[model samples]
Target: MFKRCFLTLVALSVFATVPASANGAVFDMGEQMIEISPIDGSDYYTGSANAQAQVQNTGGIQRTSFKQAIDSLEAAEVEIREEYAVYTQKYNEAKGRYDVAKAECKALKNNIKQINNRLKNVEKTKKMIFNNMPG
Candidate 1:
């Protein structure tokens, strides 16, 4: 009995140490609307946008604040892709990574007020798109 108890305890400890995928709520799929302003002297007074969404979480270890940072990065990536697509009319793999980094920098560049506002509004924006999704 004592041996069995020890083994069970050890097993439980191992399981406890193993990190589980995040159980906190996440959007299955959602859309984001972004507004892109034109660069001066650009051919078109171009404004473009893309659908942004979150399909997965990187686990719960990161705080909501940090995850928001990541989400902004992902959204920025999508934006960059849309821009590249518009300009070149061709796809390049590196554009995606550039967009992501741009967004991460944008989000991280701000102090608390701006960051908080951006993070807070993300869910609302996501839900708005989610609700509008086709049946």
Candidate 2:
């Protein structure tokens, strides 16, 4: 039937792909990979690959350069973050000191007002005593 025909076609296809020799020795069906050329303007693998050696070297150089760029950027990011943290800490300390100083200034103003009121009272007492004691 149709099933037998399908099985026969599959068997034939498999046998066709299988390499054979006169002595029936099958060599490797090694890695079958496709090589895609680098696209223009892409950050990845770029450089004149006119020769096989150049193409191989381009791959290695591209990877190394890209890795170096990433490492440098990461180092810069870390430095910037550390500096930001230090600035934040300094700002917090300044804010705390400002608050303390503001509180001290308020307390001093209250103390000065109290001292002025006492001085006014003392001046009034002096005037009353002088008015009564005068001949």
C-alpha TM-score for every candidate:
0.21, 0.48
Q: Stretches of candidate 2 above 4 Å error?
A: 1-60, 132-134
- lDDT of all predictions: 0.75, 0.85
Best by TM-score: 2
Worst 10 residues of 2 by lDDT: 22-31
- CA lDDT for candidate 1: 0.75
Per-residue C-alpha lDDT of model 1 across residues 10-127, encoded as one tens digit per residue:
9998787663433222222222234556678757656767778877875675687798999999999999989977777443446887899888887787766687888889988999
Error of 2 at 121 (Å): 2.1
Give the backbone clash total of model 2: 0
Tell me how candidate 2 scores on lDDT: 0.85
